[model samples]
Target: MYDLGDIVEMKKAHPCGVNRWEITRMGADIKIKCTGCGHVVMMPRREFNKKLKKVLESKADQA
Candidate 1:
Protein backbone atom coordinates (compact mmCIF):
# COMPACT_ATOMS: atom_id res chain seq x y z
CA MET A 1 0.00 0.00 0.00
CA TYR A 2 1.16 3.53 -0.75
CA ASP A 3 1.23 6.12 1.96
CA LEU A 4 1.72 9.87 2.10
CA GLY A 5 5.26 10.89 1.17
CA ASP A 6 5.93 7.54 -0.45
CA ILE A 7 7.63 7.44 -3.83
CA VAL A 8 6.11 5.08 -6.36
CA GLU A 9 6.45 4.02 -9.95
CA MET A 10 3.53 3.76 -12.35
CA LYS A 11 2.95 1.21 -15.05
CA LYS A 12 3.12 4.00 -17.62
CA ALA A 13 5.43 6.93 -17.67
CA HIS A 14 3.83 10.34 -17.50
CA PRO A 15 3.99 12.62 -20.53
CA CYS A 16 6.87 14.34 -18.84
CA GLY A 17 8.78 11.10 -19.26
CA VAL A 18 8.93 10.07 -15.68
CA ASN A 19 7.24 7.20 -13.91
CA ARG A 20 8.18 8.41 -10.45
CA TRP A 21 5.48 9.96 -8.34
CA GLU A 22 5.07 10.98 -4.77
CA ILE A 23 1.95 10.13 -2.81
CA THR A 24 0.66 13.42 -1.48
CA ARG A 25 -2.88 12.66 -0.42
CA MET A 26 -4.95 9.61 0.39
CA GLY A 27 -8.43 8.51 1.33
CA ALA A 28 -11.26 7.43 -0.94
CA ASP A 29 -9.19 9.05 -3.67
CA ILE A 30 -5.41 9.18 -3.76
CA LYS A 31 -3.36 12.06 -5.08
CA ILE A 32 0.07 11.74 -6.63
CA LYS A 33 2.53 14.33 -7.86
CA CYS A 34 4.82 13.75 -10.77
CA THR A 35 8.47 13.98 -9.97
CA GLY A 36 9.42 15.15 -13.44
CA CYS A 37 7.04 18.05 -13.95
CA GLY A 38 5.38 18.70 -10.63
CA HIS A 39 1.99 17.70 -12.00
CA VAL A 40 -0.58 16.33 -9.62
CA VAL A 41 -3.29 13.79 -10.36
CA MET A 42 -6.08 12.39 -8.26
CA MET A 43 -7.67 9.06 -8.98
CA PRO A 44 -9.89 6.54 -7.30
CA ARG A 45 -8.12 4.10 -5.04
CA ARG A 46 -9.02 1.13 -7.22
CA GLU A 47 -7.71 2.83 -10.34
CA PHE A 48 -4.58 3.88 -8.52
CA ASN A 49 -3.96 0.31 -7.53
CA LYS A 50 -4.40 -0.85 -11.09
CA LYS A 51 -1.89 1.70 -12.38
CA LEU A 52 0.68 1.39 -9.67
CA LYS A 53 3.76 -0.56 -10.65
CA LYS A 54 5.49 -0.62 -7.27
CA VAL A 55 6.50 1.42 -4.30
CA LEU A 56 9.94 2.85 -4.96
CA GLU A 57 10.35 4.35 -1.54
CA SER A 58 8.14 3.76 1.47
CA LYS A 59 7.50 5.99 4.42
CA ALA A 60 9.13 3.51 6.73
CA ASP A 61 12.22 3.48 4.59
CA GLN A 62 12.51 7.25 4.89
CA ALA A 63 12.87 6.85 8.63
Candidate 2:
Protein backbone atom coordinates (compact mmCIF):
# COMPACT_ATOMS: atom_id res chain seq x y z
CA MET A 1 0.00 0.00 0.00
CA TYR A 2 1.08 3.55 -0.66
CA ASP A 3 0.50 6.73 1.26
CA LEU A 4 0.61 10.39 0.41
CA GLY A 5 4.10 11.74 -0.32
CA ASP A 6 5.27 8.31 -1.42
CA ILE A 7 7.20 8.04 -4.65
CA VAL A 8 5.95 5.43 -7.09
CA GLU A 9 7.08 4.00 -10.38
CA MET A 10 4.44 3.30 -12.95
CA LYS A 11 4.50 0.23 -15.12
CA LYS A 12 4.64 2.48 -18.18
CA ALA A 13 6.34 5.79 -18.78
CA HIS A 14 4.17 8.83 -19.25
CA PRO A 15 4.16 10.95 -22.37
CA CYS A 16 6.71 13.15 -20.71
CA GLY A 17 9.10 10.18 -20.64
CA VAL A 18 8.88 9.74 -16.94
CA ASN A 19 7.73 6.83 -14.86
CA ARG A 20 8.25 8.31 -11.45
CA TRP A 21 5.33 9.94 -9.72
CA GLU A 22 4.58 11.32 -6.30
CA ILE A 23 1.35 10.63 -4.48
CA THR A 24 -0.27 13.92 -3.64
CA ARG A 25 -3.85 12.92 -2.91
CA MET A 26 -5.54 9.79 -1.63
CA GLY A 27 -8.95 8.23 -1.07
CA ALA A 28 -11.37 6.68 -3.56
CA ASP A 29 -9.36 8.41 -6.25
CA ILE A 30 -5.60 8.95 -6.02
CA LYS A 31 -3.73 11.88 -7.47
CA ILE A 32 -0.22 11.57 -8.81
CA LYS A 33 2.19 14.26 -9.92
CA CYS A 34 4.84 13.52 -12.47
CA THR A 35 8.38 14.04 -11.27
CA GLY A 36 9.61 15.00 -14.72
CA CYS A 37 7.26 17.60 -16.14
CA GLY A 38 5.03 18.19 -13.13
CA HIS A 39 1.99 16.76 -14.83
CA VAL A 40 -0.77 15.56 -12.53
CA VAL A 41 -3.59 13.10 -12.86
CA MET A 42 -6.30 11.49 -10.82
CA MET A 43 -7.34 7.90 -11.17
CA PRO A 44 -9.54 5.50 -9.32
CA ARG A 45 -7.90 3.44 -6.62
CA ARG A 46 -8.39 0.24 -8.57
CA GLU A 47 -6.70 1.59 -11.69
CA PHE A 48 -3.92 3.18 -9.70
CA ASN A 49 -3.18 -0.12 -8.02
CA LYS A 50 -2.97 -1.87 -11.36
CA LYS A 51 -0.77 0.76 -12.96
CA LEU A 52 1.55 1.11 -10.02
CA LYS A 53 4.59 -1.06 -10.68
CA LYS A 54 6.29 -0.42 -7.36
CA VAL A 55 6.79 2.09 -4.62
CA LEU A 56 10.16 3.69 -5.16
CA GLU A 57 10.08 5.47 -1.82
CA SER A 58 7.55 5.16 0.91
CA LYS A 59 6.26 7.77 3.28
CA ALA A 60 8.30 6.21 6.06
CA ASP A 61 11.43 6.86 4.04
CA GLN A 62 10.91 10.60 4.14
CA ALA A 63 11.91 13.14 6.77
* Predicted candidate 1 versus true structure: per-residue lDDT over 1-63, tens digit per residue: 778999999999999899999999999999999999999999999999999999999998779
lDDT of 1: 0.94
Residue 47, candidate 1: how far off, in angstroms? 0.3
The TM-score, computed over Cα atoms with residue i paired to residue i, of candidate 1 is: 0.95
Model 1, C-alpha of 3: deviation from truth (Å): 1.0
TM-score top scorer: 1
Which portions of model 2 miss their true places by more than 4 Å?
A: none
- In candidate 1, residue 23 scores what lDDT? 96
Local distance difference test values of all predictions, in order: 0.94, 0.94
